[model samples]
Target: MIEARQLTKRYGDKTAVDGVDFTVRPGAVTGFLGPNGAGKSTTMRMIIGLDAPTAGTVTVNGRRYAEHSAPLHEVGALLEARSIHPGRSAFDHLMVLAHTHGIGRARVTEVIEMTGLQAVARKRAGAFSLGMGQRLGIAAALLGDPQTIMLDEPVNGLDPEGVLWIRTLLTGLAAEGRTVFVSSHLMSEMALVADHLIVVGRGRVLADTTVQELVLQAGGDTVDVTTDDPAGLRRVLTGPGVEISGRPGSEQLSVTGLPARAIGLAAARHGIALFELTARTVSLEEAFMELTKDSVEYHAANTLVGAA
Candidate 1:
């Protein structure tokens, strides 16, 4: 398990990570999600002792990373794949990391096979493609056979096959009761792999909940109704506590605070013909965008409007 308690970091006058608290339990893949410049990399660096926190603390299991007897065996991380020496062979790189902790060649070979890098284990890392480099980095992280694993953007340059391989590998590790924490800005990817999510924005916790719970918190139970007589439907839905939107002449009306069955019954009673009445739940992508819209660092203007 990994825990952060009121953890914060600041550089000069700028605060990179604010006071945040969260726990990543074992036996599941916990996704760390945030936009660029949201301080995800900073927080991960602090957890691994790469950077000092200005306030609070983070722990792997029960001790700080620096306090571990064998830190590499307790926690393994792939913060950036390009951090490896380019001239070294994939096998040689793992061998060097293993040698640091007195680990042997057998373990290195095991990880090479485990990460499917055996085919290019002897190739120079500098010549490897981005996907191959990622595989090599993962191989190094697994060399110690650590109980906790953290990966940052593991699928950034992966093809479909490599992406699936990573998904399976992480899920398998978590199923074995190890703590798996992976960070990514891709909501669709995380939604497929993560059992729980820690959503951050602007260095603060936006949500710490199960994926289902987070979606529910984003008003998941609303239903979208599309009918020819949308205005009439709006009139029928006008009542206290029933929120209705989508203007008259619009093809759809968004209805909330009422069950789908109730909406159908009301439409039936009013002799209204419904083209569509679907219970709509906010997808993980939509929820993420809504939460981080304010924190996104860059935006592109709608060019079509300008052209017109």
Candidate 2:
């Protein structure tokens, strides 16, 4: 497990990570989410001892990363794939990391096969495609056979097949009772992989909850109803705590705060001609946009002008 207690960091006049507390439990994939410049990268760097925190503390397996006797075996991370030397071959890079910890060639070969890097093991990393570089980076992270894994933007440059492979790999790792913490801005991808989420903005923690809980907290359910007389349907739904709006390109009414069955029953009671009635649950992307809309630091020119 990984824990942070009142963790904080600052650079001169700007604070990168505010005082925050959270726990990353084992046997599940926890997603870290936030907008750009929201302190996620800074927090991960502090957890791995790459940056010193100005206040508070973080620990992995009950000890600071610097205090671990075998740090690589305890926590394996892929903060940024491009951190490796560009001129080195994939095999040589992993070998150098192994030499530092006295790990053997067998373990290196195992990770190469695990990440599907056998075909390009001898290619210079600088010449490899972005997707191949991501694979090599993952291989390095798994080289130590660590119990805790943390990756920042692991799927930034992956193809569809590579993306599917990562999803399966992360699920398998968590099933083995290991701690998996990954950060990404892709809400759809995170929804498919993560069991829980940690949302942050403006150097502060906004939320720490399960995926289901986050969705519930965002808002009520959405129900889409299609009828021959949308106007009549809207009139019937015009009541307290219920909202009706027109759906694009169809004779459908978007209803909120009402169940699909209730809408259907209302139409049936009125003898209205109905074509369809279905519940439209909001996507994870929509929920995330609502959660972090106000916390975003930088906005596009049009948005900024509108806000002003």
Candidate 3:
């Protein structure tokens, strides 16, 4: 498990991370989300002891990362995939890390196969493609078989196959009761893999909730119904906290603050014939935009300057 209590970081006069607190428990994939310049990298650095926190504390399994006797066995991290020596082969790189912690050659070989790096295991790191480098970094992370795994943009350089592979790997690891904390800008990918989320904005914690709950909070279920009596049905379904909207003079209505079942029941009781009734939940990307709209550091104009 990973826990942060009022964790903070500052450089010179700027505060990169404010007092943030959250717990990443085992057995689930917890996604870390934030816009650019939102202190996500700083916070992850602090967790792994790459950067010292100005205040508060972060711990892995009840101890700071540096305090662990076998740090690799406790936490596997992939902060920077290219932070490897260019002259060394993938096999040699894994061997070096394994040797540092008394891990045997068999484990190194195992990780190479596990990461699908066996074909290029003997190639120098500098000659590897971006995707292959990412695979090597992931191999190093899994070499220790740590209880906690932390990765920043693990899918950044991956192809579709590699992306799918990592997704399956992360979920599989979580199923085995390991703590998996990954930061990603891919909302669709996170929606598929993450069970929980920690969304930050401008150096502060903006949200800490389950993925489905956050989606519902940002935009409740929307129901679309095409009925013959649009006016009468609108009046019948209208209630406190309910919202109903439709195109001008159209028979279809969009509704919020109620479920489709309730709408169907109401329509039947009122003799409104419904041709279509569908419920839609907001996408994760939509929810992220809604929740972090004010926190985005940069905004692009919607219209193109040269467009007619």
Between candidates 1 and 2, which one is better according to lDDT?
2
TM-score of each: 0.90, 0.87, 0.91
lDDT of 3 at 12: 88
Tens-digit lDDT string for candidate 1 (1-308): 99999999999988889998999999999999988888899999999999999999999998999999788999999998988888899989998888899999999989888888888999889999989999988887787899999999999789999999999999999999999999997788888899999988889999898777887767767899988888888888889878888875688989877888999999999999898888977899888888889988767875785574
Q: Each model's C-alpha lDDT?
A: 0.90, 0.91, 0.95
User: Best lDDT goes to which candidate?
Assistant: 3
Question: Model 1 misses residue 45 by how many Å?
Answer: 0.3
Across 116-154, the per-residue lDDT of candidate 3 in tens digits comes to 998999999999999999999999999999999999999
Ranking by TM-score: 3, 1, 2
Give the per-residue Cα lDDT of candidate 3 at 33. Answer: 99
- Residues 1-308, model 2: lDDT tens digits: 99999999999999999997999999999999999989999999999999999999999999999999889899999998887888999999999999989999999999999999999999889998888989998998898999999999999789999999999999999999999999998888898999999999988999999888788666558888888888878888789988788865569778888898988888889888888888878777788889899889988765554474
Inter-residue clash pairs, candidate 2: none
Residue 289 of model 2, lDDT score = 85
lDDT of 3: 0.95
CA RMSD per model (angstroms) = 2.7, 4.4, 2.4
Model 2: CA > 4 A from native: 225-258, 270-278, 303-308
The candidate that achieves the highest TM-score relative to the unseen native structure: 3
